[model samples]
Target chain A: MTVAIQLGIIVGYLLLALAIGLVAYRLTDRTAEDFYLASRTVGTIVLLFTTFATLLSAFTFFAGPNVAYEQGPEWVLVMGLMDGIIFAILWYVIGYKQWLLGRQYEYVTLGEMLGDRFASRRLRGLVAGVSLLWLFPYVMLQQVGAGTALQALTEGTVPYAVGAGLITAFMILYVVVAGFRGIAWTDTLQGAFMLVTTWIALVWVLAVVGGPSAASSALEAEAAHHLALGSDFYTVQWMLSTAITIGFGVAMFPQVNQRFFAAGSKKVLKRSFALWPLLCVLLFVPSFLLGAWARGLDVAIPEGENVLPVILAEYTPVWFAALVIAGAMAAMMSSSDSMLLSGSSYFTRDLYRPFVDTDLSARREDLLARIGVVGFATASFLASLWNPATLFELGDAAFSGFAQLALPVMVALYWRKTTRAGITAGILASQVFYLSSLFTSIVPSTYAGWTAGLVGMGLGLVVTVAVSLLTTPAPDERRAIYFDGLEAD
Target chain B: MSRPALWGWIAVAIGLSALTIPWFLWGDATLVAGVPLWLWWHVGWMGLASLVFWLFARRFWGLGIESDSDSSGGSPGSGSRVDAGGERR
Candidate 1:
């Protein structure tokens, strides 16, 4: 369990991932659809695993256990578990509808769908801009997680900067060369590896700690208060906040939307959605229980994160530790590639192709997307070197920022009376409120950002509806103007 | 909308979740992970609620349907099919 050996194992895994990426690149053609949507032919099984892998990122794998370790078996674990379930249900109820529309419209990005739905290029630009801004910090957090895991596993032998740099290089090279096909195929392999390793770690830990019953008894004896449910008021608020935050945010994320569009048919997409939740339950519950067991053992973890993985390495045997490290790395790399691809696609399709040059060919668009992938990966890697104050805080901020767009976007899509003027006003109002909440400590609670964002969203909807009703509807001749160039297929 | 079934399911989900939030199960047992068993019951209920919602929605809401025509760029016999390079032909 020396630092050198741990570093060696991590490096080997990175190389293996890169090799997988290169093979996928060879299989992928140099076309806009292939590069962006995997030629819209991804099957059910691949889609299911890729979706699962992308959703279960470093935050869930590494930071979730840390939360359980620190907070015991209190509301935090309940909140986290509830968030995952909510997201799965949201995907079925609402997210699948959007996927069907994505297929119908041949949409490769959320911005594309919005532009088509609203019939406004300006709205598309605004959506793309806000998405890029929200996703940057999320991508940066993944880089930080990879670097921190490397540093911990290697006992600081691999410095944060070097660790981040190595992973970034791999991500950039893989994404730039392979695109969506590369990310999806590698994600399938990595997702399987992580699932197996997680079970192995859980079983080994349970056996070593004298089984789940002993662990449960020990944890109960140590911190009886952390095990109880909060009052009805607290549970209701906790459930509502979690359900809204994750339910809305996951469905709206640009990367996930891209996956929805990539599936070949609505049937394939639906099947993937049906199968994904089972994998999530298997992946999430064990980690939460492990954290609970740690609490019972009275193990002291670091403050503000870097706690769970560190504890795993310290307590587990060398082989099991290596497997856990591999799983964490797999989660990090799988998510990072998808995020980088989505961010790059936003700039290439929505920002560059539409405004910068309308005559740009598909080939040129693909090239720009590849270049954007490299640039984004490099920037996030540098940010990771600075070292974040905390992982969960950064993640929560990103989630709240993206959740602000949910109401306006959904309203515009399903409600014909929603006006362009209203969407503009809503975007500006929500961004201002969200930014103010971030900079000023006006909100007293940790989730104040979400509350403020929701308030702004509500105001924006009112303004949009009022303005649309006041102004005359677009003329009948102009009705074709909105639907122009749009084919239902 | 003919999807009253969908609405009915959503109500059931909300009701079930509400029921689980009260700690009605852990009467005399001491707490497990620092909280009483009733709290664990609540979390369990939330998790169950999520599962039920997902299953019912997918089964009744057409949430899992995939239209191959959308990907192939044509209706069932319109002569469009994917080639080796993934282009519609």
Candidate 2:
């Protein structure tokens, strides 16, 4: 009986999301900018929520709490505190600059902006390539999470592939029909749902277990290490590297990067970033505390399963657990839909428009972008069925891959001297080093103290600085694109 | 902000980031209200970081991104207008 009502509610919620997409499609203009960027009129609340939803994926819903449940609450250090604040700082340093340039040039995609600056189609393709390569796994991870959540929520009544496929189909439809406008609206809805439902779950769990002190007392008795940050697994080096990697990685996400351009005004952008850390605390504090408290409450989390659904089922009423699990589904779908939109933008703008047909019309381009969404989402769905790595593993790999691009990107934005060759070297060398660490044992994945991703970022920065100083920018390459308000030529 | 002033902010960012890591709290096992001291430290640090960021964002925004003759730069397509310093005019 509980499963049926829970399933019914979840289905209704999914339909509501589709309805929002349909309405967005009705309201949105068919132009490339409107389809991909909402005509750059996204307000502060929508921008904040969309970026927040896009950044917090199945990783937040599943892996984060699971990690805390197993290792300790120290995952909060890596995520809630460190990543939450650092990403906001980078948003100003990188995102604000990107937004300014986006408005000036009317740029809708990261590759379009960077490629235009260098006058290099290859550079555009490279940026698109890097984003797509790392982004697809993340898309797949969302499905993996959705599948895991549904299977757990339904008590294995819904198969994993079916659960994964369902979200993928819905995401493709939402993205193709509504584009950025629809995706952003749904993201706002999903963001609110995730926050509220998660808090309810946390509150219910605490009520059942007798609050924070009780959870803490349980941890002190059985899992004392869970309360502290200096454990072997939560070492300073590991926490910092993880936070650095994820934080910069989120900053470079094509979906999140695209949001920088979508903001309605500078004030909206500024307010969103300023309040970002506080927003993070609202969700993550509950998530980490719930996971930590589950130890005290004697919730037995299954191997390879998320701690969230388990705790929800054990502590909360069945209908409430279903609702919250659906909320987790909300997080996953919100993330996947945004990924599809951005991935399509990367395809149609960077790859299709540039390489395949330079003279394509805006309408034709929009059509192709829709097709691109279908293809990317389908590919991700198929990838989800193949091998099916853990959520944390896939998410971490993608985040690290994206993190490699952060330094060169920031340098390109803030420094007028940054050259195309410099950016190219930075992107290529860093990616190669990071990939080698992943695939081969010839180079240790962790060298000295930092992870391969951070090392790759450092290496990229060095190469970018050295090569940019050594080489001269094109005579026609203008300075105002990057440094407009400055007094310098 | 001047170049040196910008660099000063960068230095401050690094210093604050260094403090956030809690490397020095290796042996501290003190727990307040069932939560470890480190977690509380983070809550405090995050509060400080956000406050500082809010101030920096307010004071130093649009430093080089806004300009009265922004369109005058030789880029193929770009546009903006601004005061002598880069706030809305």
Clashes of each: 20, 1
Tens digit of lDDT per residue, candidate 1, span B15-87? 6534643535422345554334654554565556556755553444341222332432222222332221212
List runs of model 1 lying over 4 Å from the truth: A74-83, A231-235, A302-305, A441-450, A453-466, A472-489, B1-3, B9-59, B63-89
True contacts kept of each: 0.05, 0.31
The pairs that clash in candidate 2 are: A485-B64
Query: What is the docking quality class of candidate 1?
Result: incorrect
Q: Mark the 10 consecutive residues where model 2 chain A has the least summed lDDT.
A: A480-489
Q: Deviation in angstroms for A72 in model 2?
A: 1.0
* Worst lDDT 10-window in candidate 1 chain A: A477-486
Model 2 residue A405 CA deviation in Å: 0.8
TM-score for all predictions?
Answer: 0.85, 0.93
Q: Please write out the lDDT profile of model 1 over residues A1-489, one tens digit for every residue.
A: 466566667767777777877887888878777898887788877887787788778888877777666555443434444444556555654455555566555677878777765567777888899998989989999988888777777768788888888888888888888788878887888888887877777777777777777777787678654455443333545545654665567666778767766766555644555555456656666776677668887567666445557557667867567767877888888888999999998988889888889898888888888899999998877777675757787886777677777777666654567666766677767776777777887743335323554555565667666776776544431232222332223
Q: What TM-score, to 2 decimals, does candidate 2 have? A: 0.93
User: lDDT, candidate 1, residue A389?
Assistant: 52
